[model samples]
Target: MSKPSGKSMDEIVALCRRRGFIFQSSEIYGGINGFWDYGPLGTELKRNLKNAWWEDVVLREMVGPDGKTIEMVGLDSTIIMHPKVWEASGHVAGFNDPMVGCKTEGCKRLFRADKVFMVDLGLDPSGKHVDVGVEADSKAKAEELAIGIAKRFKIRHDANPNPIAFSVLEEFAEIPTDMQRFPCPNCQHRTLTPPRPFNLMFESHSGPIQSDDNKVYLRPETAQGIFVNFLNVVNTTRVGVPFGIAQQGKAFRNEVTPRNFTFRSREFEQMEIEFFIHPSTAKEWYAFWRDNRFAWWQSVGLTSANLQLREHEKDELAHYAKEGAGTSDIEYRFPFTAPGFGELEGVAHRSDYDLRQHAEHSGLRDKMKYFDQERNEKYFPHVIEPSAGADRGTLALICEAYTPDPSRPSGVYMKFHPRMAPVKAAVFPLVNKEGMPEVAEKLYRELRKKWVVDYDPKQSIGKRYARMDEAGTPYCLTIDGQTLKDNTVTVRYRDTLQQERIGIDRVGEFLGQKIGSAQV
Candidate 1:
């Protein structure tokens, strides 16, 4: 309302902080970069999203096309594991970003050269920078010319005669030596050294004194924890292949540059499910999850025109992935892309990569064996992972639901689906007098049994209605003099702003149908 002060992304972040949805981590000490803490409303909203995910992929897998349903079990995994786990997973060796630090005056900014170049030129780093043209054209010449300009002007790692752990992009391009930096790229005041790799994992000691054997790492992804414990669940629960292990947990990533608010964070929560299927069935399930995740966004009321599926290029797959896909592929159809089309979720086909790595390093990997006596098949199960960021989804939901009332320019409210709204309904007393307060209190207490309801008696009935509307409470109930005599109350709808008098006893039933029927 009031045209909302900052830009969309800025407004969302400000609203979140003001409403106690989230806060910067360690704010008292100037805050830690790339980490955040969820306050009251933020916690509730996050839990709502997690609850929604659990209800679908975990508690109920939903009905299949054949009209049959599947029940899936859930897993709560550890936040840290053995250090060797990272080594075998290829994280210790390959989990890195090519960084070049600048000592330009007081500006000691370390950056991903690849990203900064595109950012400076106002281009999508994920697009043409990595693509070669379809055929011989001026595009190739332009790209080559652009590369030459970038190497000389752009801040990058210095040149070297010996091999560096990770080579700079221009080095492999056979650019002229004059373009390479012999001294620090930022200052050009000191002789430069070759670029080196930096491990991204956060390490910790098991006991008092740190030692080699006691070394452990904070998990970079939730999927690995599930994969490491797959055998335990399979053997103990006696669940065969084709089952999944769903987990919601915290993960840490030491990013080189964490910008665009919480879009890229050092610490965040993730909702991941490793659906195990036969290797032959992995592709089929991958497609199935791609659609399922897409539908999930829609169910939360996201416009389909705002989302699309994109298959990864052959060179883009990770060492463990055979087939990988992203959820936000199409360009911005929806207004909020301040940081540009943020990835809401992804599904990747990881073919026994995790289990095989753990088995090779830890000597504990057992190939998942499934027997179909009639079909006579047994093999290690391939996995399709539907990984999503809880924060990203939470933020996207806010953006999607945020609406400015055209009729009432000063009024703003979230049009959240009932299942996702933090407060489903608000109960108010028409006046804080006579027996109205007591009657409204009774209704509020009763309604809380079935929904998340708030009681507001500090302001006028009109003021209370506006407050609830701003909080995205879909339904509001007010007890008036009529309620004391006839046991009837006014039920106000948030979206339509229509009020209907209903028997007090039937308010619970009436609201339940409306709230429950709303999509997630």
Candidate 2:
């Protein structure tokens, strides 16, 4: 299962476009910057990951020794909520990226220096390598130097001879500057600006009236929705303090710079859980959630070697959390892709900050309550939030599944686990004629109900299998002359290329057992 070497970030992006995994959004009009559209194969893979996450965290009903499973529930909420909510959540004033603008001659482009470095290195700008605290007093000088280097490397444009090189305009264009600005972490120049807040939330008008009172924001994270709706569900269901409300939904952030394909898009899906616990037990529950989430990722086929656990230092802890722990470093395969561990998931023990915020802002203090068996023990329940980026999870699965079988000439085959593969089993006809197509089509229809199946009769059997392999189909079923003779078909495994003759009538049962409720 060796990975393909010497592949650059551009090469992977081109391959994704060629193989129908992803496409630049609105390409006809030169495409929108920082946006992407998932193609058939990519969409399937993303969907499978989402479904798998729901099954693992939401519906599992996992129980611990403390009998806390009874308090968990799943919830869905709106993307936009009351404008005051963001204000109370600290997003209105504190959510922001430190952006440094290049005030150079004929070039004022705001360079997310962090992103610029990543782009140069073919890396993901996931806050691993770029530092934004650099004092850019010589902004003009830095822009000149950077533009000259970009030209020398000829890295500004796609390799289409369109000369998309970095150009200067009298008016500086605003680019995302989300990197850490050290007086110069890279050069150690020691001139640093005090960190300031850059709100990432997208604000909008809630009603036709464009007034200050109507200002609302698209949620920056899905966890807030669950938090806001906490009392409603708890009071209605009469659930206890240890219960949780899990959610999977879209959140919008005005990311200073959206790069690394869809990894840090302005809009993305999040799988989050707000586990309520006694204030006294918040730290323990935080640790518990952290371990559980880390284990879940490993169970889903992300190799343990490629992941790490990073604990947030005291100073780095968020304003609300008493403590927090992060997942270990993730090694992705893009250039400039940072080598350090970033937080893939985090479990933060927030001591009722959210509940207090909502209560004070909305004057609903009495509505939210918790009564424990400690008779007189009564207070707002603390929360341990386990949150992860859905896109990152999918990318990790792809990275883990990415394999190049030495036996195959095509170089690489994504060896996705049975549950994660986009297509579980590709149904193909041995040939385009002799009623084989009819049989394959019938089989495809039947299997499509139970699996994400594909039927391809245009290519030879070997070629078809290769195509499926690239798409990460776990198995391929072929209908040949032997099938008409014995009511049997060849079930070929993608990774091993081993074929087995199995009765056609029993195909579903065989696959169900083989894939049986695996975590993937």
lDDT of 1 by residue, 1-520 (tens): 1222223666667777876778999999999899888887677777888888888777754764224464468888888887777888888866654555554566465544322221122233333312111111233333344334435555332232121121233442244242234223244333222344455777788899889879888988888888778778877885666778899999888877787677779888899988887776665677777878777777766664556566667666766773433222212222445333667677788887777777778875445444544457755678888888888787667777667675743266677787778888888888888988888999899988877889987776777777776667788888888888899989888888899999999988887777663332
Which candidate tops TM-score?
A: 1
Cα lDDT, all candidates: 0.67, 0.68
RMSD of each: 8.2, 11.9
TM-score of every candidate relative to the true structure: 0.79, 0.78
lDDT of 2 at 176: 24
In angstroms, give how far residue 399 of model 1 lies from its true place: 1.1
Q: Model 1: how far is 506 from its true place, Å?
A: 1.3
Q: Candidate 1 has which clashing residue pairs, if any?
A: 337-340
